[model samples]
Target chain A: MKFSDFFRKKSSGDVAKDRLKMVLVADRSACSPEIMERIKNDIIDVLSKYVEIDREGLDIKITQMDGEGEGSDGRTVPALYANIPIRNILERN
Target chain B: MGEVIVITSGKGGVGKTTTTANIGTGLAKLGKKVVLVDTDIGLRNLDVVLGLENRIVYNLVDVIEGNCKTKQALIKDKRYDTLYLLPAAQTRDKTSVNPDQMKQLADELREDFDYIIMDCPAGIEQGFKNAIAGADRALVVTTPEVSAVRDADRIIGLLEANEMKDTKLIVNRLRQDMVKRGDMMSAEDVVEILAVGLIGVVPDDENIVVATNNGEPLAGDASLAGQAYMNICRRVCGEDVPFLDLDVKKGFFARLFGK
Candidate 1:
């Protein structure tokens, strides 16, 4: 209900798309965005790990739902939301 | 009636532009007059890939705003006798075009061309809607990677809500070596997840970089990846081409190599 209020202004199509994407992200990562936030916070705690992740460049993702056409709804989810671009390779190189 | 098919993906760099360029060329090669429109708007790269950037005089924005005739905005491909490209307005943003306007433009183009291929931008935003608005069907491109597959799934859900039922899937940039090693997901694994009819599986090849650099598509060649794309093109034309296993059994070195 609270989430719906935040997205009230969005069109039905947009809302559906948003929900589907977010949920799939959660399912894939097996971690909610909040969990990701905690992970980020913990990483920030270990200030001297090896290399610092520029928070701005911290891209974390999990495969929630992949484009599995019209049938076999929620068939076999790959169980991971795969993108979290850790660094700009070109910039580093 | 001419069909409008949007080449789209939820994530970026999964070869929506590449698919658009090649499938458009393939359709044209078969003698169907085709127009490939780049709907990425702000980040326009289709023109460069098709090698038609140097010839662009007008673009989709011009055609939509009535600033120029559709023919004037369209850059006909020099390579294929029947193919044409409606390049995006690189300077303009996505807001410059809307769904209604896009549908109008596609309708206008349909009168002459047998096929209209729209190269869609990444994400589920206004650009995606505009790219899909005029289309009778869509091709959602993704890679075997978890992120790309996730995004493709979201795109499929959106397509369904929008009532675009004829959506198909194109899994691009597949690493056959990784698949054989069980380090990466196989085509069967991806299709099982996405649940869409498989259109094609493109192996990630260095030749794609070379082909894009030279403004030529590898679909015409006999390379393994090239043959896969060609098979996809045929499937798009309603041909039933069985998919080849990218990780099928092979000799010693080949097994180690995943070829």
Candidate 2:
């Protein structure tokens, strides 16, 4: 809203929160980014059998999402999010 | 029967012993019979923190090894008649006591005390397991730093895995002025990241160091941090006490005079 505010450096508190958000997701899931990369490759290898996916645009990450259903009570739970751009679906016999 | 509570922090020097001493003294001040158990084993210091080092004849190991009766080992506090201490063995390691021994010891202590606050050792090891062995609940202490909160999250996961689900978080040494200036994380921020219930938020006060040096707990003292600990004691007793408003700005004259 203010001209000078646009150039202000991000607060350290916000920086800590952001870093923790990213780190905790990996910690809770017990899946490091290196392991995630290997898993992503495996997924690509399997999915390539029946469909064509855009490898360049592929994205995958472990993140926090709101929970639903019994006993969840609107708690935030870790979820695996994937965005694989599908180029084509192959016809199966 | 008394409730057994363990004060733990996965990282060292985060105020676990100080919190234990203050909480135990605070509960005793409230007319509750309290016992502070130091489970740091070879690195025992709770006795020193509580100013009971000169009174230790028999310790936890002495009782566990049947060298002395449990009654013979407890050291009554000089300040509070209702408060006592079961100090850790300075010469023995954590393996000196097992989980079953700790459980039996806890059950025995519960019969006489209203609250048994155990000061757990730092790190997730045999010592940590021993500390939580007989605890009915846990209070995970952590500072606002990323490393401390991260270790606390790990400790929470470990506690849950052990089926110790009634764990709460205490954010210690929080600097309100720094938080206001966005140089430090607030208690709310730490709690949100850890996803645990907040029991207390203690400010970074020089009074705590002074009290530690003097071997006096600040729980019932006339200081802000002391008031915070008192509030935490009431909360532990199921009292619906509200948290202190630590965000109060300095008065004009105080700020002007740099008081």
Candidate 3:
């Protein structure tokens, strides 16, 4: 059973709306899911440029942005934003 | 003994200096002796904001260096007999002062004034640490924008780490029309994310520009934003004033667009 079904099945539209709000909130603050998508896409693109991409193995995580020493000076994003793992996409000569 | 309060915003240009100057003036106008400190270091401007630049002689650095007495370094505001300013050094960066110096200075300033308002520089760098070093309380200024809100959330976390027991939020530059159209973050939305007590809500007004150019401030009185400031000051003093109108007339498009 999907997680949505655990609490009385939610409509697809409801889930999407919730996702949009969460996404926008995160995006405006520069830590939303869309950002991870962008990074993952870029990484996949670069990897494809070298060898065939491994979509399933491509691990991407979303986290909050950290403003450690910056203080609150810019857009309202979380401090200590997130930690993302990057891979080497060197085209073997 | 006076309470030391630092008006800070994680983001610059969100009105931390303006809030400090105006709140300092407001408290003074309330018959309380207040002193304003500019902690922006090399980018000093609280003096200019308060129209006390020309009167500065012995600045904060001079006093910190023991070149002059703290009393001598403090500029007496011409507009108010009780108000004063300890202007920051325009030539020096944030490295010139540290937390110890700020705590000692606040301890000294407490002897006479009813309030000491420090205008913090932008960012969570050395300047920020120094500004809040002696603060008994803090007022975080923020615009309704996402960036400012995000910065505020982060600052709140830092303040907690620094052990600042008292914290309040002041949302500046709010446009009620936009909120009416759901195009802007409602004050509720901001408060929801920051999760700090709401102190004041200042409207985006041209009067703020007029006040700045005229060496005046929105005191949360005469003007919409001014009146908001006044309420914040009152709330700081432990008053339970209701929220300001922040009232809006839905634009025609807002009306036509929905309920």
Candidate 4:
């Protein structure tokens, strides 16, 4: 949204790791970045209808489950786990 | 038993065959008996890359189907006595040889060779399964590109799932000038994204094209890419070889100023 965000000098090191992790998580769950963003916006819209919430503080991420193990079929089944955090919910007057 | 290492890249044109050929030759040059196996089956290229295509009397399917002995099917390399190749069958598809047969073949070869390097076909299909089935370790080759890195990540997951824990990363076709200009991903960036141990980083060298066209892998050549492959061989041999400094501009100013 900000011009600084557009011109931000991407760190050559960590940027790659972050992108890789994000892509890997999205790939395993069969979700794309655009889909994930849309889902986040939809969730926020639905939540705002029921209760007041801090949209800026909200977070959503897809991650791989801990522990390396294969499925019963002996195929490595990467567990796609999602986490959503809402800072606070306000009561409707 | 010799180590069976599969050179794989989930995406095509990522230099799996080139890496296999060079590493296989590099190991043999180090006095280890190494056999390069072309497991692509229908679309084979290891023989051509190693310049042993014309010498192929029998293919891998011939040896697996008991039509001929494995040794009888292996084509000896003219450059090294310890180096050999088991060319893939061009007529048949990936379904012709299953993972079990591939495992059995690798097991038998383990008794005779110090390193059995399998040149895996691209994609996460039957060909991939067959190649990794017998591998004690995996060396995933990927370029420093978004698509290639993404595929490499998927491959790492698949390898982990298959219980192939000893996987290493080889970032190939890297352009040092691009990395310096922040136009391309660096080797460090790829390794960070893939979350694997770094084996070697091969710079994009024109000599690679020249060598491939000549049906000879630039393993021990004086070229930068060839030196990278040689370093990979050393690492595979359990030697702690330092990574090549691919930064092009680091010494340019000093050279110009004579500092």
DockQ top scorer: 2
What fraction of the reference interface contacts is present in each model, in order? Answer: 0.03, 0.65, 0.00, 0.42
Q: How close is candidate 2 to the true structure, as a TM-score?
A: 0.91
Worst 10 residues of 2 chain B by lDDT: B245-254
Model 3 B-chain TM: 0.94
Off by over 4 Å in 1: A1-93, B247-259
Candidate 4 structure quality by residue, lDDT tens digits, B71-103:
999999978999999999999999999999999
Stretches off by above 4 angstroms in model 4 are: A1-21, A29-93, B248-259
lDDT of each: 0.80, 0.92, 0.80, 0.87
CA-only RMSD, every prediction = 15.8, 2.7, 10.2, 7.2
TM-score of each: 0.74, 0.91, 0.74, 0.79
Deviating ranges (above 4 Å) for candidate 3? A1-93, B248-259
Better of 1 and 3 by DockQ: 3
Ranking by lDDT: 2, 4, 1, 3
Q: DockQ, in order, for the candidates? A: 0.03, 0.74, 0.05, 0.30
The TM-score between candidate 4 and the true structure equals 0.79
TM-score of model number 1:
0.74
Chain B TM-score, one value per candidate, order as shown: 0.94, 0.97, 0.94, 0.95
Per-residue lDDT tens digits for candidate 1, residues B53-172, read 889899899999999988888888978888999999989999999999999989988999889999999989999999999999999998877678888877898899899979888888
Worst 10-residue lDDT window for candidate 3 chain A reads A75-84
Quote the lDDT for B138 in model 4. Answer: 96
